[model samples]
Every structure is written in structure tokens, then in C-alpha cells.
Target: MEGECIHIRRLTEGSMSYGNFYWEFIKTNTPVIVTGVSIKWECSNWLLKHGQENNIYSSEINFDYLKQQIGDRLVVVTKCSTHDESTVSVEMQFHEFLNYWRNQILSSKADVNNVTAPKILYLKDWHLKAQLPNYEFYKVPQYFASDWLNEYLEEHKLDDYRFVYMGPKNSWTPLHIDVFGSYSWSTNIYGRKKWILLPPGEQFKLLGPRGSLPCNIKEEMLIEKSVNFLIIYQHENETLFVPSGWYHQVLNVTDTISVNHNWFNGTNIKYIWCNITENLRKVMNEILEFRQYVNFKEDCQQILKCNFGLNISDFLEILCFIANSRLTLYMKRYRSKDMSGNRKSVNSHPDNFHIHYDLKSINMLSKFIAQDKIVFNCSTLYDRCMNLIDITQEIFLER
Candidate 1:
């Protein structure tokens, strides 16, 4: 089913504190739209001049400025009209894509009877921050500051989840969940986007033969199948928080540019763990004939990594790092206690509750990991997981 009505809450930038946002929206797995949030970001210069109207700033992307900064850089663009999935992705210079964008814009304004539909090209997943280290365009808002996935990736010098997406009108992404079932936030720097979000577990209703999700969902398909979904219209300088396990499709209502990130932290780490374990079980079942082999478990882990982008070891490492980091903060707070038979208040740290929540979640995950036969067989990994749990427990005791 499709086009079912579900309300998406709207909030202003200053309406709620980070803690409130986490408990109300994040823990509840609700989507929200925040306005007036990205208006002052350095990236906004791409969208607006020095004026405002009806609380909505109006301007298109500054193509000349963008070209000056990254015109010659190579970028990946997807041809939405291509029938062959294998050849859909093509690499080209940014300026060349801009030329295509100009043509698409012109075609959008041309008489329908006289003009042919332009090739809908979408430039997505550009790692702009990694490509230009000194180009600081925007800061992560406080509500999304607990991003553990990108933190681990950046620490290990791996690729980041931060991305810039640009496309002309009607360019869209197919319905899909975020990688690793992490939460994501997308902020429009210019133009507008229409988002159709299917809530957790509702995507199963839209599955086709062989259990594949449809490439392009059609209104007629909603007659037989049934699903509850929300439609969100995101405007320039507005950010959308998409919770874990939500399947979503985004279409550019106008020519658009946006920044997005996929991340997970304590708030939804259990969901992340569950997703990994479920995928691992599927992988093992698919290759059941190889179970007798000595390296079957390891091979499965690698295959999971190949398909899902992370495996058991990677999960444990992330857990250990986050556990240690939170424990260190806890210890520093503990040491700051007064010697006059009274302890210093830990509430001085704005994120005290968040830090404790992270440690607790990590500890819980570690206990689960310790019980897994595959992880228990690896001595080094087993010790690391156990030690992390113990450290988190000690920190809780001290608190």
C-alpha cells in the first residue's frame, strides 16, 4: 500500500533542547522537520542573498561560486533514465554536470509539447569535506552530535558518511533504508525536496517477487498492497531527521542541493546490533553447505562486510572505542568530586546523561557479543569485549 497519511512533526531550531529532541523523537523513532536551522550556515551563501521574505529566504544555488571551488573535480552522477543498472553510474567533471543541470533547468521551463524530457542526472554521495579539508561549510547541530559511526570512520582514516547531493527537478532515489540501519539527517541548502517515508517494518508490504524492493513505486501498485507512509515537503534551510529502519524515497521538487549523514549512537545502538546479527544469520544460512569448513565463520564475516559494509570485528571495535571514551569522561567527572564528604555534581557536563546512556548501551552490546560462539572463539576479540563491559560496569558503580 502507498500514500497512507502519517503526520511528520515540525519544529523550529530553538524550540527544543538536544536532550528533549533525543528522548521525544530519536528514542521514539519519529521523524521531524526543523526549520530556521541552516539559514546561517556558510553553505547558505550558495542559496540566499542578504534579504528575507515571509520567513522564507529565496535564491538559487550560486553556480559560479561552486564552479570556482570544485569545477574540475571528478564526481559520480547517476542516470535515472538508464534501464541498465550496471551502466547507471558514470563519472564526470563537476562543471560538465553543471552544464547538464543548466540544460535540465531550461527544459523544465520549456513548453511541454515542444520539449523532450531531459536525462535526469543526480550527483550524490560526493565526499566534499574529505575532498576539501579546509572547506568548512557547516557545523553539525547539537541534536546529531552523538554520531558514533562517522567518529569511528574518521578516527581510522576511512571514508566518511558525510555527503553532498545535487540534482535537477524530478531526479529521485528509490525506496531504501539507510546503510547499516543507522539514522540519517538531510538538510536542504537550496531548492526543495519531497520525501516519502515508510515507517519501520512497513516496507515489507511493498516487496515484490524474490523479495526485492520496487525500483520506482507507482500509485497503481497501492491498490493491492498496503503500507502506512508519510509525505514530507522539505524546503531550503530545513533539515529532516530520519530514524533507523525507515524506508524512504526523495525527489527533487526543484533543482536541489543538500548535505546528509548516516550515523548511530547509544540512542539506537541496540537496533544497529540487531540488524548486523540478523544479516549475519542470513549470510550463514545462504552458504550452509560450507559450514563444515574451518574458516566458514570468518568467511561469513567477510561476506557480511562486503555486502553490509561492517562485520563482527568492526562492531566490537566501535563498541570498545566508545566504551573507553565514555569511561574516561566518567572517571574525569569522578575525580573532580570534592573531598569534604560530598561529591561534585556531574550535571555540570551538559551531556552527562547521554554519556551514561552510551556506556550502558555499549556494555549491554558487549555482553551479547560475549555470548556469541564465533566471537567467544576468538581470544583477543573476546577479551576486548569482556573488558569493555567490565569498564562500563565499573564506571556505573563509581557514579
Candidate 2:
């Protein structure tokens, strides 16, 4: 069941708009290279300030300055070989991680036992943007700014999905999909990475008979050797837009650092709902003993809430937020006028994509909320949605 076609398209910067990105890559669930998006980022200059120009990408990225800025904040790190949650995490100061990153590959000495030592420190999932919202290193592209996950999370003072990844050469992540089946963008702020990506369902075929994907893509015991995967050698100042549900494994080609964000908007949120429901059903079936309860379905949904950070109520609330936001934006777009009171045409706004996407999303969410067999019912949710619809007609349609 390995895929036979592998493609990762490349697009240029300075001319690409959100419309171009949406229609081409987002709609198609395809990965693309966006060059020069981070050209003006201060992080790019920081990447160069610490090393020779020819090797700037692999340079230290002014680690001393970053160390001072972040101070002694402890970061979570994993051993590359132990990729599962069962893997123990070691928390160390930020300076220690950087010091180890600089020396992980370079340290060499004559060993008394003549045996090579393995470096297992892998800095993974450091939520830098959430911690430092005012960090002025780089700006997110307009195409990715309408992020519901992190925006909602940030607004509610919850943990966000924005993260920074740093690791020495040979440190690699196991193949996995992004959280909640969301699309992700990773920008190489310093150094290079080798990405191996498999589209949505192809990753399942690479799993062993026990039904887990290989922990390491380069493992000798890989279940399927011929699985078709796109290989990308990502360079500095470049961004990789990974579409939703794609399973990707990354290898640091140098002592590298990058910015990563996981997001899902109204257009592609159906995938997220489907992924969550599917997982919920699987877990429910696996825990059959819990079926004895009077509220089995609610129990399952609660289990999903604990494990996945989203319950049915949480899902509904997110839908309500997005629907309300779209209602406001659409009404604003509808009512825009000049000083002469003449209505303005909406073609000037790139956000015209919202109507089609938003309608489809609202309809889907509406159908789900209207389901009689749902886990729980909230009259307030239905009332809020109805009021928004009423306001939409009153504000946008009524002349």
C-alpha cells in the first residue's frame, strides 16, 4: 500500500499571495517550498552573526544573545532513539541545551575504552512564540495568520501550538502527523533539515504488523522499504508548508533551529473533526469495559477530552468562535463604504475565500450540533448560532 507518487512543489516569494497558497497547496493538501519568506527576518541576520558567511546556515545563530534573552528557563528534550511518550524527558536550562547543541557533533577525544558515545539530546516542541508573544524575530506570513488553534489557545491563556525545534546533526523525529490533523509551517531560521513526508494515509501502510509506524525512518527494521515519500533538503530562510494529515519525519542536516506552527482554519477543519471522531471511536472500542456506564458515549467523549485536549463541548465552542468571527468579518466586508456612502466592492479584500469556506464549515458544524444522538446538548450553543445567522441577514443582506 506504499504510495507511488511523491511530489513537493516549490513556489517563489515576493509575489505569492494567500489566494495562490490556498488554491494551490492548502486545498490540495500538498507540501510546497516557499523561498525568501523569511528573508527580512532578524533571525536570518542572527544566523549569520555567529559564523562565516559560507556556513551561515549551520552557524550558532547568536546563541549567546538568545541565552541571555531566555535566561535559565528549563526546556524539554527527548532522546532521539526513544520517540514515544514512554520515553523519558530530561528538562535542562536553555543555556545547557545550546551548549550541548554546539558541542554534540564537534566533541571528539581518545576514549580509554575505544567506544563511541551516543548523543541523545533532542530539543523538541519548545513553545517559544507562546512564551514570548512580543518576540520580534520573524513575522508569520499572511497566508497562515488566520490560525484558529493557536489564536483560540492564546486568547484563552492556554498552551499554543507554536514551537521552536533545535537539535544537533543526526537527531531525528519519528514519522508522525501534526497535532489534531492540522496543517503546519516550519521555517528554517538557521541550518538545514532533511524532511521525508508521506501524504495522509500512506503513513499507515508503513506501520509494522503491530500497527505502529516505525520509530525511526532510517531503522533497519522498517516495515516497508518502498514507501513513496517526498524528500526535501530544506535550506535556511525557507518555509515548508505541510498540509493537514501528512505524516512527516525530519532529520537535522546540521546543528539546526527552526520555527514551527500547527494550524487549522475553517476550510480544512473537517479533516480535524473526522480525525478526532475516528480516534474517539477507536479508543471507545478498545475500552469496552467502560461500556457498562449509563453515559457510555459521554464517557468516551470525556476520554477523548482528557487524551486529546478536546471534548465535544470544546469542539462546539471552537466552531462557535469561528462562526461568530466569520459573521463579523463578512458583515464588515459587506458594509464597507466610502465617505460618499457608496458600497465598496469586496474584490479588493483577499479574504473573499471566507464565504465559501465559512459557509461549508458552518453547515457541517450545524449538522453536527443538530444531531439528536450527540454526546450532549447545549441550548445556548444553538441559540448563539441562530442569533449569528439572524445578524448576518440583518446586517449583510438587508439593504
Residue 388, model 1: lDDT of 85
Residue 155 shift from truth in candidate 1, angstroms = 1.8
The local distance difference test score of each candidate is 0.81, 0.70
In angstroms, give how far residue 254 of model 1 lies from its true place.
0.7
Tell how far residue 370 is off in model 2, in angstroms. Answer: 3.1
Best by lDDT: 1
The C-alpha stretches of model 1 lying farther than 4 A from their native spots are 1-3, 48-57, 82-87, 111-114, 337-350
What would the per-residue lDDT of candidate 1 be over residues 1-399, giving only the tens digit for each residue?
354668888899868776677778887989999887787788877653646888845576677788876658889999876332232889999999988887766666775674565678899988988888678887787677889999888888799899999998878887779999999999998888999888888878888789888766654464356678788899888899999999887888889999999999987888888889889999999999999999898899999999999998898888888887776776777455431211132223335665677877787888987887767888977998889888888755664
Cα displacement (angstroms), candidate 1, residue 302, comes to 1.3
Give candidate 2 regions above 4 Å deviation. 1-5, 50-58, 82-86, 108-115, 218-226, 336-347, 375-399
Candidate 2: residue 337 Cα off by (Å): 6.5
Question: Could you give candidate 2's per-residue lDDT for residues 1-399 as a string of tens digits?
Answer: 454446676777746666666666777777888888787876665554444576543355667777766667889998776344345679988888888865654563334452666566878899877777787777887667768777778878898888888877667787778888889999988778998877667676577798777656752323336566778889877899988887888888777888889998866777787777777877688788878888887788788988887865676677767766766776676545321111232223445556435644666555554553433354654565555445433433333
Quote the positional error of residue 356 for candidate 1 in Å: 1.5
Clash pairs, candidate 2, are none
